[model samples]
Target: MSSSVTPATLDYLAQRLDELAAQFPTSPDAVDLVTLTDDIGTLGHHLQHAIERAQERFTAPETVYPPERVALVRLARAAAGIARALDTLAEALTYATTGFQREAVEDLAHSPLRNDPEVLRIMTAEKYVAARARLRHTAAALRTASTPAGSSTPRTTGLQTQPAAGPQPRQPNRH
Candidate 1:
């Protein structure tokens, strides 16, 4: 089952893509990773609408030819993969930013954010199992980055260092 999207929605998608592309970092660095991930994550976020629209159009067979339907299916599948990867990459990057707590793996897995239907959709996809494991491994690396030489845990920087409990930039579906 699928639904229809209006021309105005498609226009908004195109415009958002344009805006993001223009805002992308001109010269990238460690700091730029955040911006890059944010832009790419936004792209992935918006791509979901394209997938939905394509699926919607595919269901409305009378409006498009057989070849068009085939194309729509292809686009939808492609969009799904891209969106999942984008989110995964962002998750990995964000995980790298802070000190890893052994409890974080469980904290995030059981966190309330996991209950969100959309976040669940991406997280439960086949790729996320590895992403979760990577989070574990990444946490070990964080142990190194976060703590002082003698400490076993992250030192307080007086900085709010925790990333959002789940896949970050978990954008609201903006279709």
Candidate 2:
């Protein structure tokens, strides 16, 4: 399948990963889980291809030199490590995603509607469904938000909707 991810994009991602490696990584509430997990999975798949290529190169006739063949093995191992690193990244993102969702829901616990019959009913039911709905609702808002993350005000609850008043008819353009 064709990919929009180019060699340059991977190279840049490598560079960014290298830059982030020096930092102490612990940010629970900072969630980019949606894209990061998918990206990491893609990167791991890319590394799997590289690992296979290295194995093929190692067995090539021109690679008869033992040291050169060993180098190919090392290359494959390093690519395998990249997949492991991607796994670590995926784990971190999962933690952040969970943390963010939990925090958002916990905040909802303090809302005035907490004692409302409908709200209490949802709380009493299977919470995973509610948790997922909260995450999806927040994700949709965040994607379309014009303002900064935390600063964005709640527009609607559970689902978004246009005002009951419909849109005005569009005027034809005039020269």
Best candidate according to TM-score: 1
lDDT of 1 by residue, 1-175 (tens): 2333332333344344344433432221222344445645565555655665565565656666444444344445445544554566565344434312221254665466544443333333322344333333332322222212332211212321121222234223221
Total clashes, candidate 1?
Answer: 0
lDDT of 1 at 128: 35
Q: After superposition, how far is residue 89 of candidate 1 from its true place, in Å?
A: 2.8
- Each model's lDDT: 0.40, 0.37
| TM-scores of all predicted structures | 0.37, 0.36
Task: Point out where model 2 deviates above 4 Å.
Answer: 1-26, 59-62, 93-175
Worst 10 residues of 2 by lDDT: 153-162
How does residue 70 of candidate 2 score in lDDT? 41
Residue 161 error, candidate 1, Å: 39
lDDT, candidate 1, at 143: 27
Residue-level error in angstroms, candidate 1, position 135: 21
Report clash pairs, candidate 1.
Answer: none
What local lDDT score does residue 58 receive in model 1, on the 0 to 100 scale?
54
